[model samples]
Every structure is written in C-alpha cells, then in structure tokens.
Target: MSDPNTADCDSNLHASYYADGMQQVETELVENEQIAQSTYRLRVAAPTIAARAVPGQFVMIRLAGVNAPLIGRALAIYDIVNNDQGDPTWVDLVYLQKGAFTTPCSQSPVGTPVSLWGPLGNGFDPRPCDRLIMAVGGIGQTPMLLLGREANGAQAFGRPNGWAKDVELIYGARNEGLLAGVDDFRQAGFDVQLCTDDGSAGQQALVPAILEQRLQEIGDTASVRVVTCGPEIMMEKVAECCQKHHVDCQVSMETPMACGIGICFSCVAKVKQADGNWDYKRTCVEGPIFDAGKIDWS
Candidate 1:
C-alpha cells in the first residue's frame, strides 16, 4: 500500500486507490465557521490531522488567489472529530472569507478539493486535568474548539465522580447571530456563556467582564486554570485578569506570516527564552500558542 502523505506514487496505480483512501481524499467547505460571519469550515484530507492532531494545532492552506500576491495562509484546527464512517477524523478549520485566499475558497462548492498541509507545530501539552476554562473572542474561538473537545473526551478529562463539572467555554461576539459553534460546544456538555456587544445575546460587554463574573461566582482554586486564544489586545486583557486573580493562564497569539515555517521571519513574536535572553520566536513553529507572561504583547 502507498502512503497518502505522498500525493500519488505510481502512474500505473489503479483508480480505486484514491477511492480506497477516501479517508485521505475527502474535503469539507463552509459549514460551522460560516455561521459566525463570512466564515468557512474545511475538512482536509490529511492523515496528519486524523492520526496526529492534538489540541491547538494548525494547518497551512493555499487557495489559488492567496499565494500569488501574499502566500499560504495558516489557520488553527478548530476541532478534530470523526466523520460519519468513523474511519477518519475530519479537521475543523474555521476561517473568515475576508482575505484573498479565503474569499475565493469560500465561493467553491462544498465538495471542491483544496490543498492542505498540517497538524503542524507543537500542540497543547497533555494533562490529567478535570476542569477547563476557555476564553474566546471574534474568530479566535476556532482553536479553543479543539482544546474543548480534548477536555470533553471521556478518558483525558472525564470526572472521577462520574459527572462532568467545571468545564466552561466563555465567548464574546457582536451578537447571538455572530456566534459560531454554539451547538457544537453545547453538545460537548460545555457550559456556554456569550456576551454580545449589542446586548443581543447572553451578556453585553467584553469577554473579560463575563469571565470576571464567572470567577466571582466560583471563587479561586488551585485546580482552576485558563486557556485563552483571541486578538492580541483581547489576550493582553485576559492576561491581566488571570494575573490579578492569580489563576494560571496560557494564551495563543497571532502574527502576520508569509511562510508557515521558521525560515521566514514574518511570523516572529517576542518571548523570553530559558537563558533569559529576549528573542523573537516563530509563531509558525515555536507557536501560535505561548505562555501569556512570556511575551510583551503591547
């Protein structure tokens, strides 16, 4: 058998090969993410996503229009759940169609084939944690979905008392209409809280406002930790909230990129290394994820 990693091996190979590797040749377009804005949800045909993807991992994509002017765009894997046949896990990539690549890709039919190249970079570290607090804003909620799914899984984050407790996904958007993945999150048994700016949904303010109320309601505990991913400014505010309350927090940061690897300095973000040297780390490789305190987000 030939590896799907290599696109196709033998010129003489049978037509049924690609069909037999249906798991490797399938794709999805504009489902969950699009519900938020002009977003698109893609199911990539990669073993890398199914076999190896962990929480907060990302993938590189090249739509016809994006590469010529800029380069391939990188998007986080929102979720990695099994498709209907249950043989392969379809990766969830949630992206807005504002840019050149995404705008074109969004126009393609649902079954259109697109080139995908991930489960790239180091994902979140595995732990036996039973409680999870996730904060999200704008389209940044994409990565947290995968994180939430892992925590919701029966083995890694299941309750010892046989009842789920303290797994909350707090989101902030413009309105209830702008909220994506509401059902996906709710179906996973996550406590969902939405704060809309227009007072159209859950609460009317920023994510920090709702999160503050949550912490006030639950009080502090060593077992309580936060994982945040969003715009740079929003993440900075979240860091402040965690710091004031002394809750451990990790944040995923976004930077402009032309290459989704370390060779180009485009995706560099400032972080302090072990030796105390302040340096720039590649977001494409070192992380789209990092310790919130490690960087000067200002």
Candidate 2:
C-alpha cells in the first residue's frame, strides 16, 4: 500500500527534469599540492533547468566521443549557479576530474561538445534546524556548495526559513593543495574547518577527527544535526563519532549509477525502514540524503 499523500509530495516537492547536454566551453583548473583536479563548468544554455534545479543533485554526462564509445559519466551538482546573461540563460554542470573518462574530458579544452542530462537524484531536505554541521571528504565536498546555497535560499528577497544562528562546514583533503574552494564557503559565512591527513595546513588530521574536536569544543553534542558527504570510511567514522556523542546525523551517499535514474539499481543503498526491515533505495531516486542511523554501513 502506498500513501497517496507521500507520493504526491515526491511528485510535487521532489521532481526530476532532463537537462540537455551542452558543450564545455570553459574549463577552470583548480590546482593544489595534493591533487590536480580540473573543474569543467558546463554552460547549459538552457534557462528552464536553472530556475528549477535544487541542491545535492547530480547530472549524467556523456563524454565527447573521441575514440571508443562509452557510457555517460555521472557528476554531482557542485553548484546551483545562474547563467551569465541573467534570468534564463542556464545552469552550470561542474565536473571534478577524477577518473579515466573525466581525464580525457578534462583534456578536451573549452568548446568541447558533450552530452549531459540531469538535475538528477534526491537532494537534501533543507528545513530549519537549531544548528547544522556539514562535513565533506575529498572531492565529495563539491555538493556542499549547493547545500550552502540551500541554507541561504530566500523565498523572495528574505530568508524563507529564517535559519538560525549557527552553520558549520568541515572539509578534508590530503594537503593544503588539495583543499580547494574552502574560501568560497567561508565567504558565504560558513564556519569552515579545514583538515588534512598529512599535517600540511589547517588541522593536522582527518575530517572526522576535526569534527570530533569541534564537537568537543562546542561541548553540546545533542544540538548538532550533521549533513555529510565523503569517502565511505570518513562518513562511517563521522557517523560513529556523532552517534557516540549522541548527535543526529544525515549523510549523502554516493554510489555509481548506470542510468542516473531509477531504472538502474546499480546505485541502490541499504536503508533501515520504519518497519525495522531493511530495503534497498536507489540513490538516483529514493535518496542521496538519508538519516545516518538508518544506514547500515557495515
């Protein structure tokens, strides 16, 4: 039995749309010491998507057909940006160079025509909370940008939710060089924590370590509700840490997707349902955002 109301909410509140594949006319390389990741901010040139796209979502990208034919690449919606010409010009599909396909796609210089379809996946539920903590690991921090935007969204010209006083972000990378875009979030007024594994810059530890340290600094474990996205180990560690401290946590899980839609179960994740039975949820549809406790990372 399905609840008609919930189904309506999913249809109305959580809707999906197709964004046309556009050429990457521009590529800005964000280089740091630990990793050399290039970001390709695709110019969608389509106004419809720009107006409706939400945060914590992703797009399926088809690499330029150069040599061999391959399936499309799915990239997180790093930013929910607007077009240059203003109101309706389009959206930007930012890609973090991470794999073989991404590597070639990275080399394809500006003006390379590629296929893209998205604004896919279920994003975070950005309702009001007493306080919010966002934690990111590696390139996984990309989606945090959108979460920041959502937190700062206005229904018209004023803060719709009237979000409360505290907002924090914990970011991780190998060295100072790998910690790119920390400044952007900071400029947006997030209490940003930078951590590295090699003691290069910021805090000398992993993100989970810094997060725990921060929680200790605050000393109020129960007030923090976390939103996290990162490596499996980092998320698991963070989740465990929060639980140990009695903090409520929400995590964004990233799994490989075949269709970038519900048709393919490749991106399915095990979730503990209300009935106490575990069910598999497609990350493309059911969620990328879920309560940390409901997930059995084991």
Candidate 3:
C-alpha cells in the first residue's frame, strides 16, 4: 500500500551513501600503546579514511593478507588529524581488547600493515545550537572523542562561533582506572565531569543521573541537545530523560557488524517510522548515529 515514489525515496535515503575518497588502503600502524587495562590507543597512517571521516563514522579493519577472520571488524573513527597542508594524515582507534580479533590487533607491531576502508556509515549532524552535552560510558568514549575534536576545530559543523560555551562531557566508567582519554577531552576545552560507580573517581553516580542533574541545572532545555553512546540501558534511560525534559537527543548505537558497508544486515537496530511502525535499519549504513527519540528501545 506504499506509494512507489515514496518507497524509492526511502530506499535511496537509507542506502549506503559513500563519500568521495573512500577506498581500501594498506595503512601502516603508527602507534599502538596500551592506554588502560585491555584497552589500546591505536594510530594509523590512513590519509584517505582520515581525510573523509566525520564524527560518528567508522572504519573496518583486518590483518592485511589474512583470511582467518574472513570479515573485518568495524570500529568507530576515534580521531582525525590533518598535516600542515590541511590534509588528513592520521586516524586513531581506541578499542577494548575483548575478542580474538581485537586481542591480536592490540599486539600488532607499529609497522604492521593493515587493510582499512572507511569513513563509512552516517555520522552525527551537530546542528547550530546554544549548548551541546555528550554523555558516554566506558568504551562508548570512542565516537564522543571525535565529536569533541570537531567541536574544538572551531569551524566544525559550519558553525561560526564553534562549540565555545556550555559544551560539557559527562563520562561514566566502572572506576578511575577505566576512565580513558579524560585528559584528552579536558585538553580539548570541554567542561569534563567524571563519574564512577565505585566512587573511585570524580562523582559517585551513573551517567544518566548526572545528565539529568545537568539538564535541570541548565534550565533552558529547549536550547540544549544531548548526544550519547554507551550501554543500551544507559542510553534508554538517557532517551527517557531527554523526552521528559523536551530536549533533542541523538545516539550513536553500538552493534555487531560483519562488514562495515551496508551489504550485510548483520548490524540492525529497530527504528520507529513516521507511520508509527517499527522497521529494522542497518546500523552500519543508516546509522551508528540516529535521533534518540526515533529508536524503539524495547
């Protein structure tokens, strides 16, 4: 009963939109340092991916010339740096060593060659707003860092003033030891607030609770936008808080993806449509970043 034209439009909108300069390239490992327990900060010389990458997009990585894993693992593009000529030259990946693939990846030598393809998936669209608040938990810090980097660039999101005022980061982790990259965020000029469940860090509370308190303090909820990435329950609670406060919010979902491209539907999330129906969306293409209110958390 759908209009053919409308259906075609929807298909095109949801289809994989590849940016220019996307390609499979052999990236040399520039730095692979253990930042925390079972966590690593990996840097690669991937000019192509870095040049096109935006906040919330991801890259697929695999050992060069190895087929044992068969499929590459998708990782969020953590950060990007440009050279003196303003050409992107480096990309960073901050990941937890949890699985077989990542464990081996953590031990990869600095000079090892790896296959990478990216800047894939839709990224966060930071609209012109008065304030931006990012709430993250544990390894969810990945995409948030890139967002911070963009905000620090001053001209990011085509905004003139940049994210100058009322930009805050509410980061929650299990403990102090697990709080990675706090210094980096602080150095980027964000009003960083740290939370820990064990009371071993800054504030003793969960991220959502902190976010709710911060929103209340802000008072002008209409002028604020909350962007979050973390545990599903935590994000769900964040969505609830945003809804109650009448604030706009976006979420970067974490889902297992076999192929970073849209060819595989392995990474799917239930999204609510305007027609009041729920449909499965490929997180690798249609998202990783989506309007928090549009997701059916149940």
- Best candidate, lDDT-wise? 3
Q: What is candidate 1's CA lDDT for residue 241?
A: 85
Candidate 3, residues 163-239, lDDT tens digits: the string is 52557899999999888888888878788999999999989999999999999998988878889998999999988
**What are the Cα lDDT values of the candidates?**
0.66, 0.65, 0.80
User: Could you tell me how far off, in angstroms, the CA of residue 220 lies in candidate 1 after the best superposition?
Assistant: 2.4
lDDT tens digits by residue: candidate 1, 107-154: 776656565666555555444454678888888788776677666563
* Span of 10 residues, lowest total lDDT, candidate 2: 25-34
The residue pairs that clash in candidate 2, if any, are 21-116, 25-111, 33-177
Q: Report the Cα lDDT for residue 78, model 2.
A: 59
Highest TM-score scorer: 3
Better of 1 and 2 by lDDT: 1
TM-score of each: 0.81, 0.81, 0.91
Residue 98 lDDT (model 3) = 90
State, as a TM-score between 0 and 1, how close model 1 is to the true structure: 0.81
Clashes of 2: 3
Candidate 3 C-alpha error for residue 176, in Å? 1.0
